[model samples]
Target chain A: MAIKVLHHGLATTVQDLGRPGYFHLGIPVGGAMDRYAMRAANLLVGNDEGAAGLEAVFIGPKLEFTEDALVAVTGADMPTKVDGVAQPGWTAFKVKAGQTLTFDFLKSGARICIAVSGGIDVPEALGSRSTYPIGALGGYKGRPLTAGDELPVGKSNLASEGRNVPEALRRRPGPSAELRVLPGLYWHRVTEESQQNFFADEWKVANEADRMGYRFKGGRKLDFVDREQPFGAGSDPSNIVDSCYPYGSIQVPGGTEPIILHRDAVSGGGYFMVGTVISADMDLIGQLQPHSPTRFVKVTMEDALAARRVRQLNLARLREALA
Target chain B: MSARYTFGGDEHLFVECSEEMSLEAFFTSLSMAKGVRESGIKGVTEICPANASLQMKFDPDVIHPNDILKEVKAIEGAAARAEPVLKTRIVEIPVFYNDPWTHETLMRFRERHQDPTGTDLDYAARINGYGAVDDFVGAHSGSPWFVSMVGFVAGLPFMYQMVERQRQIQVPKYLRPRTDTPKLTVGHGGCFGCIYSVRGAGGYQMFGITPMPIFDPTQTTSYLRDFMVFFRPGDIVKFKPIDRDAYDQAVEDVDKGRFAPPIREVSFDLREFQKDIDGCNAMLEGMLNGH
Candidate 1:
C-alpha cells in the first residue's frame, strides 16, 4: 500500500510529466528534469508514461517496500540494489515486503528516476503530482521527501520482473555535450562579437545547476550594445524589463554566466535571454554533472524542428521496443 | 504598437510587445493572449502573457511552428481592433509597512543594496523625494495599482502605480540579488511593486510585509479556498497600511479561517482610466471603501 522512507536521498521529490497550462500564473511545468528517463522507467514497470514517480538527485533514497511491487530505476549510471543484492539499471525488478532498496555511489550522471509499478499515489495538485518546492505545491507535502514518511502507491496493472530497456535507449550525458540553441528576439541586445564568441567558447556546468536552471561558467562574458537604459529596467546591461522566461531559455544575468532554465524555472524575470536550448537537449542537461564541459551550437528554426522530430521518433522507438 | 515575434525554441514562440514596460504594452500582451486562446490555436499547451510580452508553448509535432506563427500573426492583427477593457476585481491588501520581517532581511543583505546604510523603506523613500516614511507610505497606499504581471514566482504580482508617469515611484533593484526575501514581503523595483508570495530569492527593494496570503498552494487560507493564487494579471490592489495590533489580529484570524480578503468585482476600461486617471482611481478606491 505504501513505500516507507528509510533514508531520504539528497533531494528526492515526486514528479510526473508536470502540469503544463499554468505558466501565465508564474507556475512552471514542474516535473522530472530527465523526462525521457521518467517515461522509460514507468514503461518498464508497466505504468502510464506520465505516472508519478520518485526523482532523486545525486544520492539515492533508502526505501522499504511494505508490499511486493515491481520497480525500475533509470536516468543515471547508479547501481541499484534490493536487500543488498545488485540489480541492473533500466530493468524492472521485484522487491518483496519488508525488503530495503538502496544505491551505490553515482557512477556518472546527476539524477535517477525510480518508477514503481503502482505509481506514487500523491494527491494531484493543479493536475500533477510533480513537486514544485518554490510554490510549495504538489508532491509529498510540497517538498522533498523526508525519512519516516509513508508514500502511498496506486493500484498496479501488474508487470513481471526482468523487463529491460536497451543500453543505447538509455540516454546519459557524455564527457562533453553540445547543446543546440535558437537565438530569440533578445539576441539583438547582445553585441554581435559576443554572440559569436558565445558559440566559440566552451562552458562548464556550474554548481548552480538544479531543477530551476543550469548555470554554465568558464566561458567569456558576453558584451552588450550600449544604449540608454529603458524605463523600468535595471541599470546593468544585462537587465531587461521583467519578462517571461520560456523553458530552456538561456538567461545571462550581468552577462557573466548563462543559466538555462529548466522545469522549475521562475515564469518571468529581468535578465536578458540570449537564446533557448533546443527541447531535444534539455533531458540530456538534467543528466550532466557539475563541471561537465559543454558547448553551444546555434541552429535555425527548421533545424530545431527537425531535431524535435528525431526525438519524437526516438521515443516512439523506445515504446516499440518495450511493447 | 509594435511587436517582435521570434521562436523561443522548437516548442515556444516568444512575442515581445514592447522593449519597455508600459500599460499599453501589458494591454497588448493581454489582448494577444486572449486572441490566441479564442482562436483555439491547436497544440498550444500554454500561453503566458507577461509584462510587455507573451509566450506560447506549442507542440511542433502537432501544428508546425510555422503554421502557428502564421495564425498568431493574424490573431495579433485582429486584436488591434479589440477593446482594451477588463472585468477584474479590486482587493484591499493589508500591509505593515516597515515590518520587522522584511526589515531584518533587508538589514541582513545591506551590502547588496546600493545605499547600505539605510533600511530598504528608508532608502526607497529618500530616493523618491519623500522626507518622511509616512509620506512615502501614503503615496504608495494612496492609489490603487494595477497588476501588470503575475510571475517571477508563483502568484507574486508585479504592479504599476495608477498615477501618471511623472508621479510614478521608481527604484533600482538590489545591486546584487539577495539569497532570500520574506514571504508576503511587499517589494518594489523598476517602477513596479511586487508581493513575494513565498519566501525565496529576490532582488527587489523590500518595504513591508502583508498579513494576508498572496498565494497558498495548499488552498488552506480563508480567502484562497476557491483558488490557490489570490492575484491575477488584471486584478487591482489597494494597500491598506495597518498597525502592529491589526497585523497580529489578521494573522490570528487567518489561523482560525475567519480572514476573508477585502475584494470587490469591478469593470475597468483602459481608455476610460487613461482619460481621467486621478478621477478613475478615486472612484475605484471609493468602490473598495464601500465594500
Candidate 2:
C-alpha cells in the first residue's frame, strides 16, 4: 500500500518516538515534537505507540491513498477532509482506494500528527524512522516530504475503522502555554532580579523558531554576575566554559533573547544554560505557535517527577480505554 | 576530586568534572562514562561526555533519578582513585591552510570579525605573536591534538593541542555569527579547534579547510562503513598541512568514494601523558609516520 503526495504542505516529515542511545555520538533525537499527540494518533489506529507517522507544521499535506487504509488525525485542530467531506480528528476512519485526503489551515496548534493504520514504512536509520534533516539521516530520504513522493505503508491487522478517543481525553492546543522549568544549571550566572523577571514575565515566541530551538522575545535583559572569563569560555558575559546542554535547556545569548533548546538541538555548547523545561511540558512546547505568549513556571524536582508520573498514567489509561 | 551533580529535570543528570578544561578532567569524565556504560544500567538512554563534564539521559519510570546519581558518584570516585588507560586511535587528517573557500568566507564576514582589517589567519597570527600566518599554521600543525569532545553537531570534534599550557593557541569567536560556513572548514574558537561537519551557521575563526569528510551519513567509504563519524572522544588527530594539488586530489578521492584517512592504533595512558606530553606525542608521531 502507498500514499502519493499531492501537496507536501509546510515542513512535513515522517517521525516516530525517536532514536535513543546515540546522543553521545552527537546525534540529536529527532522525533515528533508533540509526542503525546503522536502516540494518541497511533493508538487510535491500533498501531504501536512508536509507529512512524506524518507530522506537518502550520499547513497540512494533501495525500491520495492507492489502497484501503485506516487513518487517524490528532494534535492541532487542522480540520481534515476526505473527498471534500469534513471529518473529525481524534478518531480512526477508513479511506478507500483512490480517495484524496486534505487538511484546512491550522486553527489551533502549530503542528498536526497523522497516523495511518500501518506506519510509514521508511527504512530506520540508527534504529529510528524519525528524520534528522541536519545530519541527512532517517525518515523518507532523510528529508522533508515533497511533491511526487510515494510513501510505502506497512500492513496492519490491529487497526479497525470508526474508533474514536473520548473528548475528555483529548488535549487542545491553546494560544498561550505555561512551561514548567527546573531553574538551576547555570541559573546562578543570572542576576536574582532577572531570574525573578524570567518567571514573572510573558515572553512571545519569535518567528525564527524551528526544530533546533525556539527563540523568545519581549523579555527583560538578563545580567550575568561579573567575573573573569574562564580559559575556553567565550568573551560574552552569558558564556560559560563549554558544557553539556540538557534536551530542554534554556540559554540567553547577550542576555537579550532566550532560546530553548529542543529535541534536535546541539548536544553541548559554550553558552550558560540557566534552566531546563521539564519533560512533562515538552509536548506543550511542540504545540506552541509563533507569536504565542509563553510563561516559564518554576517547579521543584519532586513536582516535575509527579507531573511525569501523571502523564504516564494518562497514557496507560488511554491505551486501556482504547483496548 | 568531587564532581558536581545536578538534575536536568528528572530525566537527565549533569555531572561537571571541573570549571576549567583540563586533560585530567576529561579523563575523569571518560572513565566514569565507561564505568556507567559497562554497568548495564536498565534505564540509561544516553551517556554523553563533553569537554570536562558528562550528561546522562534516563527513563525515570524504570530507574530512580537518585539511583543513577548514586551510581555516577560511585563511578566518579573509582575513576579518581585509579589511573585511566584508554584504548585510542591516532588519525592523520590532511588540511589545506588558507584555502580559497574559507578565505573568501572569512573575508565576506570580516565585518563580524574581531579584527576586520586583516584576514582571520593574519589577525590570529598577529595576536599570537607570530610574524606571519605561515608561522601560525606551523605552530597549529606542530603537535597532535586530542579529541576532547565530539558534539555541537554529529562528527564535529572539539580538539585541544597536546602542547604545554603556555604554548596553547587562544582566539575569541566571531563578534557575531556568520550566516554560512563551508562544510569541512577547519575553525578555532577560544582554546578549541574544530572541523565543521556540515555547511551551516558558525562563529569559529576560520583558518583552513580539510579535504576529507569527517561525517558521512551515507557510510559509503570503507573507513566510515562501520560508523558515520570519523572521530571519537579519545582519538588523537594530527593535522598534516597539504598544498592545493594534494587538497584537490584528496577531495576527488573523497568524491569518488576512495578516500581513507591515515589511521593508526595506539593505547593512551592518561597518567603517563600528564607526566610528559612532548615525550608521549613524539612516540605517537613515530607511530603515525612509521606506518
Candidate 3:
C-alpha cells in the first residue's frame, strides 16, 4: 500500500502521460520525459499505459515497500538490486514486505522509469499527476521526492510477477543519437550556411540540459540574417516578436548553443524557433545524457508521419503481447 | 492582412497573423482560434493564441496534419470577413511601485542591468525620455494594457499598452538575465508588461510588486477556486498605483483569503479600437474605475 523512501537520489518525481489542453493558459505539458519507457514499465507491471510512475534522473532512489508488490524499471541501464540481490531491468518481479530497492551507478541513459503494480496514487492536479515544480503544482506535494516521504500505491488485481519485455523491444542507450526534425517556422531566419552547419555538426548535450530544455554544445555558431529588429522584439538578432513556441521547438539564442524546448519548457517566448523535433524522436531526446553526441537530421513531413505510424504500431504490438 | 501558415514539426501548426504586434492581428488570431475551438476539430488538443500568432497542437493519429491545416485555414478565411467582437474582462490590479522587496532584488542584480549605476526605474524613465520616475509611472498607469499572450509561465500575461505608437513606453531588457526574481513582481521589458506569476529567472526591468496572487494552485482564494490561472489572453489589465499602506492592507486581505481583483465584463470591438486607440482606452478605463 505504501513505499517508504530511504534515500532520494538526484531528482525523482511522480509522472504520467502529462496534462494536455491547458497550454493556452501557459501550463506546460509536464510528464515522464521518456514516454516509451514509462509505458513499457507500466505494461511490464500490468498497469495501464498512462499509469503514474516514478521518473528518476541521474541517480535512483532507495525505496522500501510496506506491502507485497510487483515493480518494473525501464529506460536507463541503471544497475538495480532488490534486498541486496542484483536484478535485471525491463522486467517485473515480486518483492516481499520490508524489502528494500536500490540502484547502483548509471551505465547509460539519463532517466529511469519505475512502475509499481498499481500506479503511484497521487492527487491529480489540472488532470495530471505530473509535477511542475516551478509552479508548485501536481505530483507528490508539487515537488521532488525527499527521504522519509511515504508514497501511496493504488490497488492492482493482476498477477504480473515475472513478466518481462523482449530484448528486441528494449531500448539501449548509445553514445550518439540521430533526431529527426521538420525544419520550418523561423528556420529561414538563420543564414543558409548556418542552417546547413546545424544539420552537419554533431553536437554534444550540455550539462545544463534538463526537463525545461536540452542545450547542445560544440556546434558552429549559428548566424542570423541582419535586419532591423521589429518593434517590441528585443535587440538580439536571434529574437523575433514574441510568438508561440511549440513543444520540442529548437531555438538558438545569441546564435551559440541550440536549446531544444522540452516537456517542462515555457509555452511561448520571444526567441526565434528554427525547427522542432518530431514526436517520434522526442523519446530519444529524453534518453540523451549529458556529453552524449546528437545529430539533427532534416526529415520530410511525410517521413515523420510514417515514423509516427510505425511507433504507434510497435506500441500496440507490445501492449497486445503483454496482455 | 493574410496569415503565414507554417508547420512546427508534425504535431503543431504555426500561424503568424502579422510580423508586428498589433491589436488587430491579435484579435484576428483570437477570432480564428475561437472558430477553430467551436468547430470541434477532431484532433486539435491545444490552441495557444499568442501576440499576433496562434499555435495548435494536434494528434496526427486522430487527424491528418494537412487536414487540420486546411480546417484552420478555412476558419481563418471566414473569420477575416467578419467583424471581431471580443468578450473581455477589465481587471484593476493594485501595484506598489518601488517596493522594498523588488528594489532589493533589482539592486542585487544591477550588474546584469544596462545601467549598473542607477535603479531600474531611473534607467527606464531616463531611456523613455521622462524627466522623473513619477512621470514615467504616470504614463504607464495612465493607459490600459491588452493581454496579448499568457505564457512564459503559467498565468503570466504579456501585456501591450493601448496607446499611440509615439506614446508607447519602451525599455530594453537586462544585459543578462537575473538568476532570481520575486513572485508577483510587476516587470517590463521591450514593449510588454508582465506580472511574474511564479518567481524564477527573469530579464525584465523590475518596477513594482502586486499583493494579489495571479496564480493560486491551491485555489485557496475565492477568485481562484474555479481556475488556478487569473488572466486569459484578450483580457484588459490596468495597473493602479498604490501606496505602502494600501499594499499592506491588500496583503493582509490576501493572507486572510479575502482579496479579489476588481474586474468588470466588457465587449471589445477591434475596429473601434483601431480607429481611435485613446478613445477606446479611455472608455475601457472609465468602465474599470467606474468614473
Measured over all alpha carbons after superposition, the RMSD of each candidate to the real structure, in angstroms, is 1.2, 1.5, 1.1
Task: Note the residue pairs that clash in candidate 1.
Answer: none
What is candidate 3's TM-score for chain A? 0.98
Interface RMSD of 2: 1.0
Tell me which of candidates 2 and 3 scores higher on DockQ.
3
The residue-by-residue lDDT of candidate 3 on B92-191, one tens digit each, is: 9999998999999999998898898999999999999999999999998999999999998899999998887777888988888999999999999888
Rank by TM-score (best first):
3, 1, 2
The C-alpha local distance difference test score for the whole of candidate 3 amounts to 0.91
lDDT of candidates 1 onward, in order:
0.91, 0.89, 0.91
How far residue B279's Cα lies from its native spot in candidate 1, in Å, is 1.3
State in Å the error of residue A127, model 2. Answer: 0.5
Q: List model 2 lDDT by residue over B99-144, tens digit each.
A: 9999989989889998988899998899888999999999999899
Candidate 3, after superposition: displacement of residue B149 in Å?
Answer: 0.6
TM-score of chain B of 2: 0.97
Which 10 successive residues of model 1 chain B have the least lDDT summed? B76-85
List clashing residue pairs in candidate 3: none
TM-score of chain B of each: 0.98, 0.97, 0.97
DockQ of each: 0.85, 0.78, 0.87
